[model samples]
Structures are given as structure tokens and as C-alpha cells.
Target: MGLFGILIVASILTYIFRDRLFSRNLETKDDKYNAARKERMEEMDRLLDKINSRGIDSLTPGEKRRLDELSGKK
Candidate 1:
């Protein structure tokens, strides 16, 4: 094959595999972090419901701690 044909093939392969290559470089910690983030969001939703029903001042210390942690203050 000519140089142009090889370049075209190389370009196509690079394009097709670029995302996979980059994604594989992501740390496994990212998955753990995402799971933790999702869990935190769910917890926040539950806390919000509790606050809506019983008022924010009614939250237990643990719930408040979770809220503070989420807010980056803890």
C-alpha cells in the first residue's frame, strides 16, 4: 500500500480507539468515588425529605454530620 493508504488506516484506528484508550487510564478510585457520590446524593435526598417533614432542626447529629461532610465542611 502507498503511504497515504497507511496514514488513512492509522488515522481511522486512532479515532476508533481513542476514547477506549483514555477511559482505561482512569483510576479505579474513580468508580469508587462515583459510587460514594451516588450514595451521598441518595442520603441527601432522604435527609431533605426528613427536613421537609420534621424541620431541619430535628435532624440527628449523624444526619447533620453527613450534611456537613457533603458540604465539605467536615
Candidate 2:
């Protein structure tokens, strides 16, 4: 194979095995917990912003429940 062809094949192989190659360094439980917490905080911020711009009643029932759930985690 020419250099270009070899490079293309190598790139494809890297893509095919990327997950397996990287899974060994997967996040620990604490990392996952922190990530989930951060996501919840972000969601709560978005909900709070909506409430500020619109009104608390503007939230859907699901959103209100989610906000409560996130808040209770703190």
C-alpha cells in the first residue's frame, strides 16, 4: 500500500477500536457521581432561568418534579 493508503487504513482501525482502546480508563464511581450531579445542577439552572423569565407556573409538571429531585440531592 502507498503511504496515503496505509494512513487511511490506520485511521479506520483506530476508529474501529477506539472504544475498547479507551474503556480501560473509564471514570470511577465518584467521577460518575460528580458528573451526574453537575448535569443535575445545570438542569436546575436552566429551570430556574425559565422561572425567572417566564414564571414558576411555566414549568411542565415533569420539569418541576425534576427540579425538586435535583434540589433534594443537595
| Most accurate candidate by lDDT | 2
- Per-residue lDDT tens digits for candidate 1, residues 37-65, read 99989988888899999999999999999
* Global lDDT scores for all candidate models: 0.89, 0.90
Runs of candidate 1 exceeding 4 Å displacement = 1-27
Model 1 weakest lDDT span, ten residues long: 19-28
Using all chains and alpha carbons, the TM-scores for the candidates as numbered come to: 0.53, 0.61
Best by TM-score: 2
Evaluated at residue 17, the lDDT of candidate 1 is: 97
Q: Candidate 2 overall Cα lDDT vs. reference?
A: 0.90
lDDT of 1: 0.89
TM-score (C-alpha, index-matched) for candidate 1: 0.53
What count of clashes does model 1 give?
A: 0
Candidate 1, residue 14: lDDT: 91
